[model samples]
Target: METPSTSTSSYQRDDGPVRATLVGIGLTVFGLLMANVLTTPAFLFDPALLEGLGNGSIAGRTLALILNFVGMFLAGLLYLLATGRGLAWIDLRIPSRRDWKYIVAGGVGSLVFLFAFNIVTTLLEVSAAESQIMEIIGGDQTMILIMIVVVFLFNAPAEEFLFRNVIQKRLYAAFTRMQAVVVASVIFALVHFPMYVAFADSLLSTLASLTVMFGGALIFGYVYAKTDNLLVPTAAHAVLNAFQFTVLYLAIEYGIEEVQAEPATLAEVADAVWTVAVALA
Candidate 1:
């Protein structure tokens, strides 16, 4: 398929595959460090700052999320400045009704991909890694509700802007749309390696998480490549995350057990089905 937007700069047009891949990896690594690594300093800077901000505390989660948001954009800004690029490179725009079609497709596709991947890992005797968000919010209904907006307003936008808009787009200089998307997706997934290491119980579980994240990243990259609209992937990402949190919130409200990212999850599968049905309608 022809990509709607092509890299137009002389540098973009002239870069070779090896250079593009290396630079893409570098940018992704830098972005990850900014968002994830910088998070540790909160405790080091002042232990008092962490008084009410740990794990299940709303204050802690919110602060971490806010810092994450700032970190992503901070790295992106520096990258743009150092590379002589502009904000236009990471095109952020309001979606039209037409764009919404791609957004919904991307969102539904991501959910379905995640469910299927988890199921496959289970069959292979490896459980998928649960999202850290589940650990953060726990049974706090207020935090669950807060996450719905945070993922959309802060997390999704920051991540999509750095990963999809910048990192994935950078690969366009040397790769086809599909190839670029795949490569970028891998990088995006690996960026979460540390989280998996911290949260996953075994190597297989960590791999499963990386695999599932890579698949979801593929959807994010493809929709952005197709529409050349950053918002498509951003909204899709927000939908994917918010969907999980919403499910947990509802489960808690109904006094159900804590949800985990496991195979054959009836709630997720059912909700995804409903999403597809509505999308198709």
Candidate 2:
């Protein structure tokens, strides 16, 4: 019998594994420093000072959002510095033609999966169908348009690069694909812990949020697997966030001002299921 070929696969680069380990360490350090920096301002600075500008004013909210966004970005930069990689290795470059095609497909797939999952949960007595964050924002068409543009340009893309592209990709080199995804997903969910506490409004809701996000890591991972391009996954991530933001905005503006007061119930759950089934059909 002929000896089996043992030639290494071309996808296995010389530096991938070593670089991945160092990057993971750097990311952990970066996250710690970022938390410290953000929390410090709260102690020395007056909470009222920010509140005075406007309680949940658009500009105030925007500033807070920017700070959170940039803080994570700085963390990612720290990782790059530690790993001796530049911005390019972080997968921050603009998407190419091929990247855009796969990105659209991934985006569509993300929406489809999101809808399906919601449907399943609804049938299981989980929730009613409701608009997501972006849907709410979109009701104010002018503001929504601007927010979408900003998100598409910066907020969405930046987060994707930091969490998924740079960090997740590097981790993949060290761990099995599934292991890498779990690590990445855990980090992704932890960073948004506050959101789960504030918006999710219940233990079950929080767990659901965890499931959605980790599943997101898998979807993004699928995009990367197909294209070997970060842009595709990044775009998908952006679309998902923007969509959620819009939905939440609309929900608040139109009805159900307080999530804590009125929880998603059995009827809502059925709505969610029906919506997904129809969409899939």
Candidate 3:
């Protein structure tokens, strides 16, 4: 009888409990909560935390940017420590040349799908998802820029490594592809609960985010299954995030401010409904 080749098998057969990754995610969440807590004003009489601190000067914006970097770095570190993996994973140096090609293609394709889906859903109106998204994001271009940078460059990489490459990969070793996607997607969505609560009033935006995020998880998981490599999904995630951020910047740059109409178009309403139907299906 021929022995099973270890090389053809998944790495890390021990497949330890995703404790480390979960810990890392937890610590990062805690750090964010702390950041928000510390920044809050001491009293009602005082102005809001981090409000107008830089006087709209370059120094102020630069300081804000620096702080954001610090936050991301700390959160990433905590996540790594909890997961028992060194920071090397975030560099994502394992993917092969073929992996890169697939990642790029998959990422771009997913972005296109998301963008088109949003446009259609917004037109259909079954969900008020788009406006809610804008509200949670807040109307601060500087802050939004900082967020985009952190998410794409720092948070996204670390998260993909932990969630997809590390945790999901291990899980898939014991489950089917669909099961892996479902588990990974649930975890991914849970991580964003804070953001959802922070923008509770934006029902449409919240729904939109839920759909986008879960859909992203499913796509990334599928990529991993196809390639058996973390690099593909990580790169794909980064591309999608960067693309979305770019679109947002373009909209803002073009002076597309808040929504003008009280009730969205019937088309948008219908799209929202269909998006939900598709997601549910």
Candidate 4:
């Protein structure tokens, strides 16, 4: 369970859980604030831009997604610099062949977890909150492809860097490894509550969705702890997202007729799938 933080002599003393929690919260807020400040002008000024930036439009959603990545990244970078650590401390090095095993295991584990959780939710009649969010971000084929690329390249890496590399590592110094994992995972799950709130119909369903996300975050944190390679968890996160998106794409392309009496357009289906994946991730 030794991380680069554990191995390095130059690492700073743990700031304790309270400070870590405060810093993590601060970073999240700062990122959101920055995104709002940066995107609001463009969102307001241009008519065509306004249309593109509509809630369900590809351009609008993509802009939001990119702003999220930028905000988290800048915040993480500032945190590291303030703490006297550099980018190297985050361990962005490419995973080795052995590390790849953990990455693959994480991906497989996520799929298994999601499958089991979905079955249980289905039995209990709990809806997937992400699906509703997807319906709001309607897009066409070109937009879908662009969304996939952005998600795979920017969103996955930026999120892993912020959560696993920075937040989890800092928390690890203040708590037992298991405690750190639980706490970090809780934060991770909680951060997603806004999306769930926007789309979930009932409290129980929202709780169920968060519970599944918490489980996934636990797996991600564990893999990062074990391997000490950010890429391992990032790969896993990307794979999980890719799998989910692929399934949605296939469902939209092939099963739409079977599922709906008058099927939605392929673009609409793609939009729904992409938006859901974005929210869930």
TM-scores, all candidates, are 0.82, 0.68, 0.61, 0.81
Better of 1 and 3 by lDDT: 1
Clashing pairs in 4: 134-276
Best by lDDT: 1
Error of 2 at 30 (Å): 2.6
> What does candidate 4 score on TM?
0.81
Over the stretch 1-105, how does candidate 3's per-residue lDDT look in tens digits?
111132125334343346534543565466565444433333222333235442344334434434543554455455556767555434344666777777877
lDDT of each residue in 231-263, candidate 4, tens digit only: 899899887776555545554555443322211
How many backbone clashes does every candidate have? 1, 20, 22, 1
Per-residue accuracy of model 1 over 163-192 as CA lDDT, tens digit each? 777777778778877888999998888887
Report the lDDT tens digits of candidate 2 across residue range 179-237. Answer: 66667767776655565555555666666666666677677876665555667787887
Q: Return the number of clashes found in candidate 1.
A: 1
In order, the Cα lDDT scores of the candidates are 0.72, 0.56, 0.54, 0.67
Candidate 3 global CA lDDT score: 0.54
Which segments of candidate 2 are over 4 A away from where they belong? 1-29, 32-56, 92-94, 128-147, 198-201, 248-281
lDDT for 15 (candidate 1): 72
- In the order shown, the candidates' Cα RMSDs to the true structure are 5.0, 7.4, 8.2, 6.0
- In order of TM-score, best first, we have 1, 4, 2, 3
